[model samples]
Target: MAARVWRDPVLWLAFGFGSGLAPVAPGTFGTLPGVVLAALLGLLAPAIGVPLWAVVLLALIVLTPIGIGLCGAASRRLGVHDHGGIVFDEIVGVLIPFLLVPVTPWTLLLAFLWFRLFDVVKPWPIRWLDRHVSGGWGIMVDDLLAGVFALAAVGLSVHFWPG
Candidate 1:
């Protein structure tokens, strides 16, 4: 399958640097790199005395445009247009919760499951975006919406039990 997606770096990135290559639950596995990134950023942010939330938000701001580019180009190259292998969008979604919620093991698990739920279920507007949006926006917007939902739910938990 390398021939299918090996030609382009953007495709490689959009595939989560090969995390999306898993045969089962590609989307779920594809999110691993993002989780790893969130964990690392959580560790590093405190070293610099920066708030974890601030670091996550900054990553979203910086990486999103790049994700858009990668997702769009990769979709075109794969010609599947939001193929299961194109999971950089899920990473972006997972990152959203990391913006406000600290990346603990429990929180990471919650973020992962919750983001996957929203992404798979695609409730209301999330589904709407998935159906209506096209290209990179199409690929990334729904997952970003999932991230927002996850952020809200996890944010509430963080507030209630901010240990």
Candidate 2:
């Protein structure tokens, strides 16, 4: 069956667009689209790419409400809330670890592990923000915090690891 644009943008967003429609684990599927996106973006140059990556995060933070609004409107049009199809949060969250880290296999592996840990754990202010914030921003903030934790660990590992 053909997909309706009214439901999603493109499949590259991953099943996140469709996953949003899923009855369960929409967040998990929504996050996968982001993982792939990070790997692809990691291929870019650190000079331009790092800043660009940060900009993407800024844009995501800035644009989240817009996205949520769109989602909300879509939900109203379709009748739902917190649709699984929206995965921009994952994209932004995943980008945090990759922003400055070297895109090596080992580094990528470590970053991936760390990011997932923080995301799932949701420590400190991340947990607070996740609980207090409402709407799309709330959905996205926790992951961004997770990325921060991952980035810190990756940075420290790079700084402290012995040759």
Q: TM-score: which candidate is best?
A: 1
lDDT of 2: 0.60
Q: Backbone collision count in every prediction?
A: 0, 3
lDDT of 1 by residue, 117-161 (tens): 888899999999999999988898899999999888788877786
Regions more than 4 Å wrong, model 1: 3-7, 159-163
- lDDT of candidate 1? 0.86
Give candidate 2 regions above 4 Å deviation: 1-29, 46-86, 160-163
Q: In candidate 1, how many Å is residue 35 off?
A: 0.8
What 10-residue stretch in candidate 1 is worst by lDDT? 1-10
Q: Write the per-residue lDDT of candidate 2 for residues 34-138, one digit (tens) a residue.
A: 666666655554545455456556655665565555544554443433345555565566667766675566666666667767766789988898779756556
Query: What does the lDDT read for residue 159 in candidate 1?
Result: 78
Model 1, 139: alpha-carbon shift in Å? 0.5
Clashes of 2: 3
lDDT measured at residue 116 in model 1 versus the true structure, 0 to 100: 88
Q: What is residue 62's positional error in candidate 1, in angstroms?
A: 1.0
TM-score of each: 0.92, 0.65
